[model samples]
Structures are given as structure tokens and as C-alpha cells.
Target chain A: MEFVVFIIAGLLAIIGALGLIGFKNPVHSALSLVLSLFAVAVLFLNQDAQFLAAVQVIVYAGAIVVLFLFVIMLLGVDQAEDLSVEPIAGQRPIALAIGAGVLALSVLFISVAADGGATGQQSVTAEKVDSITGTAQSATAALGDNQTDGTETIPNIEQLGRTLFTDYVFAFEVTALLLTIAVVGAVMLARKPKGELAPLPVIPGRSGTTDETEELEDA
Target chain B: MELTSTWYLVLAAILFALGATGLLVRRNPLIMFMCVELMLNAVNLTFVTFGNDLNDLGGEISVFFVLVVAAAEVVIGLAIIVAIMRRRNEATADDLSALRG
Candidate 1:
């Protein structure tokens, strides 16, 4: 059952990525990206990174992609891009060659890893044993019965939160600062230039209705 | 055969390659931005896979930071793109060759 699910999710992810590249319309590509992101989130769930999966869906698919679409619509740049123009000479051929090389190298490295040693499950089990032993001693010393066992391991979210707040506190706080600066910068960049004159109140003298004139003025 | 971390890592690498290709192939700035997001997602997958493989929370925590950074990047990047598009009526990256000497 798990294998079947993995296969399905992986297929969806790859298909979505292909669609992202294949589609001519930017809106279609954005939608395809959402599909890819959601599929990856499912894979994350399968890997037991529930928190990361939820964050991936909420922040990435929900917020960031939505922002992309909003910009697309606002700019009215949704028209299909002209494919014939190679504005940058010889870019596509080079990109394709490099992309192929990267894929080959990555696959080769993975195959050569650890002499085709233990499967993922074996490595995970071994790591779990090591962690349990290592944490049992320290965690037991600090928190007594809060110690974790193999079967009763702390949930991924809880572990993530504990680590973020304690071990990675500085990095987490820096992320908050970064987000604040980004928000400020985005607002500054997206806002209309301050010196631009506000549209005059619709003096209904000339052509179309008050609404049309207001629209014209705004434009 | 059972699925393993290697499988996920390989899948991520493929996705990353596709993203890089798309970034280079697509001339539209918006599409290139989407490709960048794709690459970031691939990296996120790798981090989670390693976190699971190592039985440690460090990878996951790093993923959180990456997410934050990605979000920040998206906002700033899109804002820049929109500003450029508004001035020029299109967002093709190749057309923005003002810096070309």
C-alpha cells in the first residue's frame, strides 16, 4: 500500500513539473506548480515530516503561489510568451546540455553511495537506534520520564518545535527578522510612486459615464 | 522493491534539474521565478529526506528556515518583477539588458 502511494505521488509530482514547463500560459504554469507542490507535500507526509508537509502546503501552495498568480493577473502579462525568439543566443542548447549532465551526475552519485549498502529502511533503523540510545541518556537526565523510546518516539512536529525553539533559536529568530524586512520591502516596491498625482474627482463633462471617466483617469 | 531515501533523493535531483532547465529555457521573468520556486521545493525534499534518514531534527529545522527564506524571497522577487513589467508592459528577462555594456 505504501509503495503504491509513493509511486502515485511521485508520478503526480513529475507530471506536474513537466506541465509547468510544457504549458505556454503563465497561469497554467502556476497551477501546474501548485500540483507539483501539493504532490511533494504528500510525499513529505509519507516520509513522516508532517510539519514540513503542512508548511509546504500552507506557505508554498497557499500563500506564495497565490502571490505569483496575483502578480500575473495584476500585470496583465498572462499572454503566451513568444517561443520563437531566442533573445539570448544559444541559451536553450546550453541549458539542455547542463540539465542533462546534472541529472546524470546526480543519479551516478546516488548509485555509488555507500557501495549500494543497506536500504533506506536499514539506515533509518540504525539511525533511530543511535538516536534513541544517545537521547535516552541525555533526555532522561534532563527530563526524566520524558525520555523517548523507539516505539514511543516524539512526534515529528513536537521534535521540530522543540529543536527550533531550543537548539536553533537564533536561526529561527533571524528568519522572523528576515520576513519583516521582506514585507516592508515588498510594500515599498509594489506601491504606486508617491509623486504620481491622484486622479482628479470625476468632473462629468466630456466623453463617457462618470465610471468610465474615473477609470480613464485612474489609468 | 521497497521505496527508500535514495529514491526520494533521486526524484529531487530530477526535479531540480527540470527547474534549472526551465529557468534557463524560459525567457519570461515570471516563468523563471516559478522555476526558482520549483528548485527550492526540490531542496526542501532533500532536506526532509536527510532528516528522516539521519533520525535527527536538524534537517527539519533547517527546512523551516529555508521555508521562511523562500517566502521572503518570493515577496521581494515578485514585487520587483511587477515593477519592471509595469514600466515595460512585458516581463521577458532578455529584454532587461539595460546593464549590458
Candidate 2:
């Protein structure tokens, strides 16, 4: 059942992504991107990362894509000319060959790696616990308690928050600073210019050309 | 019928490839930006899949960071686009060759 849910979510995400790439209109593409982001958030929720999933929905689907739409609307670029540049005739074959070669090499690597013995599935679960808790102490406590009760225990959001504020505070502050810089930069870039670069050109028949026009008419 | 999570990863990879191709081929800046977003979401899907597959929370946390960064990128990217559109009426990526300055 969980696997089925994952499959559905993945399929929806892929379909939305396809739409995002295939759509010619910017607004439609942004909407499809939203759908894809939402699907990924659902997958995050299924992974037991409730807080992350909520943040995903809020940040990606709610805020970011809406910003894109707003800019698209504001710019009023509805009549965009199609400007897809096809690869030069000779370059296409070379590019295709390189891509194929890379794919083949990756396939060969994966096949060889898959044949190796699965030495560390259990270790992965252990490592997952440590990384999720963001500390050895909490993970140990969680595991110790779980082992005593013979039940699986997942760390909740509060523990995650504690770690974020305590150990990861510097990183969090850095992210905040980066966001502030981005916002300020965006605002500055989007600000209207105070002056024109050049004076408007005087039209031949307009803009105080009436005397000349009358003389020409009389002649 | 049990489908493996690897199948989802494969699908995500295909979507990512499509988005990358669009980004490379499309000369419209807006479409390129949209394709970039598509690629990011594809990566997010892959992260979520691995999170579930490994029963790991870190992957999801990473996804959160990815979302935040992607949002920031879109905001700044759109601002840049608006600036470019204002300076030059054209939004085609090819016209941006003025960046050679």
C-alpha cells in the first residue's frame, strides 16, 4: 500500500514535470511546476518528514511559483516569439554520440556495482537514524528506548527543531542572510529607473514639424 | 503487484532529462527558467524516494533545503528576467548575448 502510494505520487510528479517542460506558455509551465512540487511534498510526507513536507508546500508551491506567475503577468510578455535554436547539423551528431557514450558507461558502472554483495543495508538504517536526529545522543536515546520496548520509534519535529536551533544555528543564520541578500538584490534589480538613457527621437511629421509640413504642403 | 521504488527513481530521472533538454534547447528565458524548476522538482522527487526507501529523515530535510533554495532562485531569477525584459524588449535567451560585455 505504501509502495502503491509512492508509485502514484512519483507518476504524478513525472507527468507534471513533463507538462512543465512541454508547455510553451510560461503561466502553464509554472502551474505544472506547482503540481510537481506538490507531488514531491506528498512523497516527503510519506517519508515521515512532516515538517519538511509542510515547508516544501509552503515554500515551493505557495511562495516561489506564485512569484514566477506574478512576474510573468507583470511583464505582460504574452506574445513571446518561439526562439528554440536547434543544434547545428554537425554538432547534433557529436552531442548524441557523447550522450550515448556517457549513458553506456553509467549503465556498465551500475551493473558492476549491483553485482557486489549487499554488505550494509542494516548499517544504512542505523546511519539514517543518526543523520535524522542530527546527533548521536538523541539517536542513541531513541534506539535505546525502542530496543527496550521492541517497537520502532521515529524522532518527531520538536527534536529536529532543537537540533536546528542548537547545533545547526550557524547554518540557519547563514541561510537567513542569504535569503535577505536575495530579496534585497531582487528589489534593487526590479526597481524602476529614475531617468531615461536617451531622448526620444523626433518623428519626421510629428513633434513641432507642423511648420515644415505646411511649407511642404504649400510647395 | 509490488513495484520497487527504483522504478520511481527511473521515472524521475527521465523527467529530469526532459527538463534539462528543454533548458538546453529552448531559447526563451522564461521557458528555460521553468525547465530549471522542473529539474529541481525532479531532484526533489528523487530525494523523497530515497528518503522513503532508506527510511531516512535526512533526505527529507535536504529536500526542504532544496525547496528553500529553489524558491530563492526563482525570486531572484524572475527579478533578473524582469530587469532584462525592461532593458531589452526581447526575452529570448539568444538576445542575452549582450552579457558578453
Candidate 3:
């Protein structure tokens, strides 16, 4: 049953991602992206990364995509019109070749990795514990002693929070600072000036003479 | 072959490729933004898969940060897009080449 859920979530994510690219309308694309992000969060939940899943929903699906929609609406840039002339003449071939190359490389990597049988159930659990604790030695030791069954043990949220707050505190604080800066910058950029100001006169010394000369000439 | 988590990951990869292709091929800024989001979600899927495989909570925490950053990006990105549209009167990415050297 759990495996079925994972399959469904993965399918949803893939479909949503495809829709994001397939749709021409920005709103539709954003909606598709939202769906994809949500599906990913579900996948995280299935992985027993409950905190991550919740954050994924709250941040990516809820805030980020909504911001994209807001921008689209504000700009009124979603009109169905082709903005650029097709084939700027020189760049299309290069772009296509590069894209194809990337795709080929990705496929090759995936195939090679898959052939190595890297998807066994045991290694994943061990990797997860090591990542969370930031020490492979302890986790490996624990795994050696606790080898009761083949089923992987899922770590609890409390352990996760403790690890994050303790070992990764500085990184978390830095992230917070970065977020604060982003918020401030966004607000400043979004705010419009009340009105345009007159241009300041250049050549301060000549300004008065030039104005007097102009008046005398007109008289 | 039997259906496994790896199969799901492969599907995610295919989806990611589709999204990347769309971004590369499409000229629409909105569509491009959506495609970028699709790619980000694909990465998220990989994180979750690895997380599940390892049975650890760190993946979840990282995903949380990704989500938060994504949200902040959307808000600011939209504002900038709107500003650009108001100035240009057209939202097509072709007109956004003012900075192109």
C-alpha cells in the first residue's frame, strides 16, 4: 500500500511538471507547478520527512507560486502574443545542440546509476541517519548493532529538530538573515515613487550666467 | 522489472527533462518561470526519494528550506515582472533584452 502511494505521488509530480511546460498560459503553468510542488511534498512525507513535506507545501506551493501568479497578474504579461521573431538566425542551432547534449548526458547518468543496483532498502536508511546526525561512524555503529530486520528504521521529527538546531544552527541563522534581506529588497523594489522630480541643472557656475544671457537676448 | 522507488525517480527525471526543454524552447517568461518551478520540484522529488531510502529527517528539513526560498522567489519575481510589463506594455521575454550585451 505504501509503495502504491509512492508511485501515485511520483506520477502526480511528473504529470504536473509536464503540464507546467506544456501549458502556454502563465496562470495554467503556475497552477501546474503548484501541483508538482505539492506532489513532491507528498513524496517527502512518504519518505518519513514529515517536517520537510509540511515546509514544502507551506513555502513552495503556498508562497512562491502564488508570488509568481501575482507578478503575472500585475504585469499583465500573460497575453497570447508571440513577442520575438522566430529563429534569431544564429542561436537556434546552438541552443538545440546544447539542450540535446544535456538530455543525453542525463539519460546516460541515470541508466548507469540504475544498472549499479543502487536502490536497495538497507543503504538508504543508513544514509538518512548519517546525514541527519552529521556523523557516519555513529550511525554505522548503530546500524551494525541494531540489525534486527531488513525494514529501515524511520527517525522521528524530534531527533531531526534537535540535529538541525544543534549541529546546523549557524546555517539556519544565515538562512534567516538571507530571507530578511530578500523581504526588504522586494519591498523596496515594489514601492513606487510618488512623482517624478525635475532634472537638476548641470554646470553650476554657468547656470546663472546662461539664464541672464537668455533673458537679455530675448529683451 | 518490478516497480520500485527507482522507477518513480526515473519518471521524475523524465518530467524534469520535459520542463527543461520547455524552458529552453519557450519564449514566454511566465512559461519559463513555470518550467523552472518544475525543475525545482523534480529536485525535491529526488530529495524525498533519498530521504525515504535513508529513513532520515534531514531531507525533510532541507525540503522545507527549499519551499521557503521558492515562495520568497515567487513573490519578488512577480513584482519585478509586473514592473517590467508596465514599462514595456508587453510581457514577452524577447522585449526583455535591454540588458543583453
Candidate 4:
């Protein structure tokens, strides 16, 4: 079952990714990206990351891609792009070669490394800990997880909430600040310029357009 | 065959490569941004897979942060794009040189 799920989701993700790049229309690309996002979300669930899977769908597929489509329409840039006009000769082939190189390098690294390079994070609270070395010390215990002594697993959302509020509370608060800054920046950027775009003064002797515009306003 | 974390990692690498190629090849700013999202999602997948393999909560928590950051980034980026697009309806990534001065 797990293998079947992985294969299907993985294939869907690759297809969506290809559609995102292959489509000439930005809207179509955005829509295809939605497909890819959904597939990733499914994979998230397969990993038992239930909360993240929901966020992946809600935030990524629901919000981000929608924002892309909204912008595509609002800017009136939905028309099919003329992809044939490649000003730089051989840029596509070169970029494709670089991409293939990157893929090859990562695949080689993954294949050569033992256990896919995972550190086998230590679940210190567990009764019989694995002999594998890990960086975490009392991390699982520190999170107030009830699963330490009980056979029952702590709910995914509860575990995440505990971690966010306890261990990384400061970082969580910082995200609020980051979000506020982003909102302000977006509003400022989206706002229209207050006045006309006057041409720069031709000669320095004129003392500049700033003075000219002010004088005109005064008049 | 059992599904291992390595399978997911390899798939993510493929997704990341595709995104990189699109980012390099596509001249449209919006399309480039979409490609960037693709790469970000690929990283998110890798993080989740590792988290599962390690039986760690840190992976999902890190993904939470990433999602927040991605959201913030998109907001600012789209606003800038909108600002630029309003100035000239048919602006491509290359035309951004107008701001160089």
C-alpha cells in the first residue's frame, strides 16, 4: 500500500511539475503547479505529517497558486507567451544541461550515502532507543509528549503545537514580525504613486524637476 | 518493494531540477516565481521524508516555518510584480533593467 501510494503521488508530482514548465500560458502553469502541490500534500500524509499535508493544500494549493492566478488576471498578463523568442542563443540547452548536472550530482550523493543521509533523530523518551548516534538529547522528552510511556501516539497537531509553543516559541513569535513586515511591504509596493511622473530636468542649470513640480503646485 | 525515504529524496531532486531549469529558461517573472515555489516545495518534501525516517517532529516544525516564509515572500514578490506591471503592461524579466539606474 505504501509503495503504491508513493509511486502514484510521485508520478503526479512529476507530471504537474512538467506541466508547470511546459505550458506557454502562465495561468496554465499556475494550475499545473496546483496539481504538483496536491501530490506533495498527499506524500506528506503518507509520511504521517497530517498537519503539514493540510497546510500544504490550504496554503500552497489553495492560497499561493490562487494568488498567482489572481495576479495573472489582474496584470492582464494571461496571454500566451511567445516562447520562441529566445534572445540568448543556446540559453535553453545550456540551462537544461545545468539542470541535468544538478540532478545527477544529487542522485549520486543520495545513492553513495548510507541510509539516504538521514541522521536518525533520537527519540530519547522511547523505552528502547536505537543504538544509532544522533544530535538530539532529550528533545522528544522536552516536548511533553505523552507517547513516552504509553503505547498510544500523540496526535500530530498536538505534537506540532507543543513544539511551536515550547521549544521554538521565540521563533514562532518572530514569524509574526516577519509577516507584519511582509504585509506592510506589500501594501506599500502595491500602492499607486501619489503624483505624475515628471521627466527629469534636461540641464543642471534648471535646478531640477523637484523644485519645478513644487513651484507648479504652489502656483 | 518497500517505499524508502530515498525514493522520496530522489523524486524531490528531480522536482528541484525541473524547477531550476524552468527558472533559468523562462523569461516571464511570474513563471519564474512559480518555478521558485516548485523548488521550495521540493525541499519541503525532503524535509518531511527525513522527519518521518528519523521519527522526529522537527521536520514538520521546520516546514511550518518554511510555509510562513514562502507566504511572506509571495506577498512581497507579487506586489513588486504588480507595481512593475502597472508601469508597463508587457514587462518581462529582462525589462527590469529599467530600475537599474
Q: Give the Å error, residue A48, model 2.
A: 1.9
lDDT of each: 0.79, 0.66, 0.64, 0.83
lDDT of 4 by residue, A95-153 (tens): 99999999999988887753434454333322133234232324455545464554455
Task: For all candidates in order, state the fraction of native interface contacts they contain.
Answer: 0.66, 0.42, 0.52, 0.74
The residue-by-residue lDDT of candidate 2 on A131-174, one tens digit each, is: 66645235425545543453345454654565566555676787
Off by over 4 Å in 2: A80-155, A196-219, B1-5, B51-56
Q: Which candidate tops TM-score?
A: 4
lDDT of 4 by residue, B1-101 (tens): 97878899999999999999999999999999999999999999999987777676778888999999999999999999988787666777875654333
Clashes of each: 0, 0, 6, 0
Q: Give one digit per residue, the lDDT tens place, for model 2 in B36-86.
A: 877787778677766656655456556666766877788788888987787
Q: What's the DockQ of model 1?
A: 0.47
Per-model TM-score of chain A alone? Answer: 0.75, 0.68, 0.67, 0.77
Error of 4 at A159 (Å): 0.8
The 10 consecutive residues of candidate 1 chain A with the worst lDDT sum are A198-207
Task: Show where candidate 3 strays beyond 4 Å.
Answer: A81-103, A118-133, A136-155, A196-219, B1-3, B55-57
Structure candidate 1, residue pairs in collision = none
User: What DockQ does each candidate score versus the true complex, computed on alpha carbons?
Assistant: 0.47, 0.42, 0.41, 0.58
Candidate number that wins on DockQ, 2 or 4: 4
Winner by DockQ between candidate 3 and candidate 1: 1
| Docking quality category of candidate 4 according to DockQ thresholds | medium
